[model samples]
Target chain A: MERCRELVRPALVEAVGRLHPWTGEMAAYALGWADTAGNPDPGGSEGKGVRQALTVLGAEAVGADGRDAVPGAVAVELVHTFSLLHDDIMDADTLRRQRPAVWKAYGTGPAVLAGDALLAQAVTVLAEAPNPRAAAAVRHLCRTLNALVSGQAQDLRFEHRPWNGPGAVGPEQYRSMAEHKTGALLGSAIALGAILGGAPDETVTALERAGRHLGLAFQAVDDILGIWGDPAVTGKPTHGDLRQRKKTYPILTALADSGRAAHELAALLDSPQRIDGEAAGRAAALVEEAGGRAATRDEARRHLDTAHRTLRDVPLTRTAAQELDTLFTHLLDRTW
Target chain B: MERCRELVRPALVEAVGRLHPWTGEMAAYALGWADTAGNPDPGGSEGKGVRQALTVLGAEAVGADGRDAVPGAVAVELVHTFSLLHDDIMDADTLRRQRPAVWKAYGTGPAVLAGDALLAQAVTVLAEAPNPRAAAAVRHLCRTLNALVSGQAQDLRFEHRPWNGPGAVGPEQYRSMAEHKTGALLGSAIALGAILGGAPDETVTALERAGRHLGLAFQAVDDILGIWGDPAVTGKPTHGDLRQRKKTYPILTALADSGRAAHELAALLDSPQRIDGEAAGRAAALVEEAGGRAATRDEARRHLDTAHRTLRDVPLTRTAAQELDTLFTHLLDRTW
Candidate 1:
């Protein structure tokens, strides 16, 4: 993972720097490369670079050199950051990676433009690829972008749905959102690697399927951690999604369950009062009591199993396949 | 113009409808294709498809069928609307085409996402072009997008600069902003048509140059009209830009000129009081007295001449070149 991050970081930096200086500064700040003053911030942390690693891993899985997928990786990461910049504003998240979010630091206008520039840069980078596969890469990336935006729109609307009314969010709706919001990019990342590596269409489709399953599992785990993980490890408050009344998988699962705990959890969420820490804790306990936590964990495990099963049929070398197996297992096992 | 709008409107509708339903609805509203309830609003006027017409005209100038450039035309128009959606938000303008802006009708979140989806869709539309020229089209459009974003960033930053401070806006800076903000897309519109039509590199370059001059003239005329245009025809309040203290071409030009009226206008703008109707009227008079209005009009004519001169050397057929000349002249002569 570290090696992949190192591989993709320079290209990402140079790609962002190609934007207009004003937007470039904001992009650099959002990407954790430089501070607001345009100076490199060595202490700032870039996130796990999971998407780029997956691109490389997907290429390697197709028996192609991973370096061939660097453009694809860079494009995926840019799109991811683009979404992050805009999502942070939509969600009113004031901090990212323990620093002021781009919108908070530079004001909403610049942050929005930075996101726009980054997204345009993503397509530009792919179009500049020195191969015929560039066209296919662009097409796939655009589809992914459409899905990401759609998912985000749906997620925003979901927030306003009645807590327990007929139009309330359900596990199915949450899973659909997760698929569009999270799965689209991951699937695109894997498919990009395969297409860029000159893999067959069948192989690209299979890789995309595996990526979708992996994304579902990844998001499910993230939802669980949002409510249950340690703040120190998760970088989010315990029951954070619950306190905010986010219709995450666990909360929706609990809402759907037919039991006293489910009713109580719904009542707590539907209340007009803000959920303070104590109420958040009680809400978490109610979710657990309604079997929501276990259900979410089981759902994640099911998706992980599907990913493994799908990969088993892929024609990867033994070494590459084993690496993927280990990586998937490790990812689902992380406490954060 | 009506014939061209008829030609492009269906495809534009189809293109936006391809987005997710929610974003599609917002996009439709933003584009004036539909109302808030997703019904076609007959009274809602779609802006003249000027960019698309330029694109088709560009293709015809290169001896290609105008229909051949529809995809490119669609891409350019999508990008134009995409910038409009975001710019309306940044400018905090509640109205567009005499209707409430997208961000005003729908909340900012959906408006932003709709803009994003439209941009991605623009790229996707280009990538789907059957010809291999699609890649070049995407690249040019991306460059145009970068310029548009940069221009917008500059425009936003210009708003906060002191009227006569060290960082105050000047004519050159304002012209650069106009070139990027308005010129880039127009230039891209022509270039995309040429590229899509399989025009030689030289032809594409000439068309781009012509487009840039036209853009500069377009914006300069827009600035002049903003203050002096008849409200009954222009559909904007008298001195609307002045009321908002927008550093438009005329204002910036007047600021840079050395004269008594220039200093007085600067002081009036620098004052803490808002420019209401009386002050806006006074400011307009002072700007004219400072030679700002005349200068802006002269600048527009100069760029119009440049565009005509550049087109004179291009290899377009007599009919097509004459068509472009008449169109450019007609456009610059419009009162509203």
Candidate 2:
């Protein structure tokens, strides 16, 4: 992952540098390279670069140098940042990476423009790639964008739906939303890398499938952390998702039950009162009592196992495959 | 132009249909095909289809059928709608085509998502084009998006600059902003069509130059209409730009002068009180008295003449060139 970040960062910087200076500053701030005042933040802790790492590792697994997939890695990273910038505005999130969100630091209009700049730069980078499969990469990226937008729309719509009834969000709906919102980009990351690495179509398909399963597992873990994880470890307030009344995976699963705890949880959530600290704590306990926590853990393990099975079945370079396996295992083991 | 719209509308509808239903409804509303209730509005008056017309004409001028550029036309129209949707949110304009803007009708989040959906669809349409130059089309569109973003950022930044000071926006800066915000997309529309039609690179370049000049002329006319045109014809309130204290071409030109009228106009604009209707009328008269109106007319005429000269110099199909010439002439004559 460190090597992948090293390979992707310079190209990413160059792509961002092409933006207008005003938007460039906002983009840099959003990407964690600069502070709100447009000064470099040397101590800034950046994203883990999981998607870019997958791109590089996918290329390496196809017997290509990691460097060959730099453009795809950078493109995916930029798209990821673009989604985050826009998502923050849509969600009204004021903080990102322990600092002000782009929309909070620079007004909404500038943040919107910055997100747009990053998205445009992502496409331009891929279109300008020297690889023969660049067009295919662009198509894949656009499809991923479509899925991302659909997923976001679904998630937003879910917020307005009833907690329980005919129109309430179901577990299946949650899975589909997660698949579109989170899994599509990860799937595209590996597929794009494989394509750029000159891998066969079937190999790219297999890697994409594995990447998607990994994404689902990752999302399941995040849902768990959003509710029960320690704030110190998660870098978020305890029960943050519950306070927001977000229809996350665990809550949806908990509400899926027809038992006493599930009914009580739903009644509490449906109340007009805000979910303050005390209510959030009780809601967390009720979700656990209704088997939401256990069920979510099982779901995560099941998806992780499927991802591992897909990865093992594919014919990949031994060293890169082993590295990817270790990385996936570490992801599930992560506390943050 | 009507033929171009006939070829492009079906394709545009199909492209927008690919979005999530929620976003698709908002996009339809933004495109003036639907009302606030998501119902089709049979009586809705649509845009003039100038950009798409240029695209189709560009393809025909290169010896290809108008249908050959439908994807390019659809792509540019989608992008144009995307810009309008986002611009309404940024500018906080409540009305579009005498109806509530997308952001005003829907919420900001949905409007933003709809704009994003349209932009993504624009690229997808170009990427999925059967033309061999589809990759080039995508690159050109991405570059145009970059310019559009930069222009919007500059426009927003100009709003904060003093009307008369060292950092105030200058005529050159306004020109650059207008070129990027307006000219870049128009240029790309024609260039993409020509590329798809298999025009030589030099012909594509010449046509792009002509389209850019046409765009500048068009923007100048829009500035004039914003201030002095009849409200009924423009479908806006009287002195809308002056009321908002927007730094348009005429306003910028008027502020550049050192005469007494220019000083008085600056004082009126710099006042803390909002410019109501009466004050807006006064500002308009002052702008005209300071020669802003006449200078802006000269600027528009110069650009239109340059565009005509470029068209005359280029080796184009006689019928298609004559059609484009007619369109350009009509644009300046338009009151709205």
Q: Residue A245 of candidate 2: its Cα lDDT?
A: 93
Interface RMSD of each: 1.0, 0.8
Question: Which runs in model 2 stand beyond 4 Å of their true positions?
Answer: none
Go through the candidates in order and give each one's DockQ. 0.77, 0.83
Q: Write the per-residue lDDT of candidate 2 for residues B233-293, one digit (tens) a residue.
A: 9988789899989999999999999999899999999999999988999999999999999
**Regions of model 1 farther than 4 Å from truth:** none
Q: Which tens-of-lDDT digit does each residue in B1-336 have in candidate 1?
A: 566667777778789879889899988887777899999998678887889988888888899877778888899889999999998888888888888989899888778898999998999888888876888888888889888988998898888788896888888999999999998888898899889889999999999999999999999999998999888778889999999888998988888888999999999998999999999999999999988998999999999999999999888967777877888888788773
lDDT by residue for model 1 over A1-336, one digit each (tens)?
788788878888889878888888888888888898988898668787888988888888888888888999999999999999999988889889888999999988788899998998898888898866888888889889989998998899997798787898889999999999998898888889889888899989988998889899999999899899999987788889998888899889988999999999988888899998999999999999999899999989999999899889889867767777777787788773
**Interface RMSD for candidate number 1?**
1.0
Question: What does candidate 2's lDDT look like per residue over A181-275, in tens digits?
Answer: 98898888888888899999999999999888888889999999999989888789999999999998899999999999999999999999999
Q: Which pairs of residues have clashing backbones in candidate 2?
A: none
Model 1: per-residue Cα lDDT at residue B42:
88
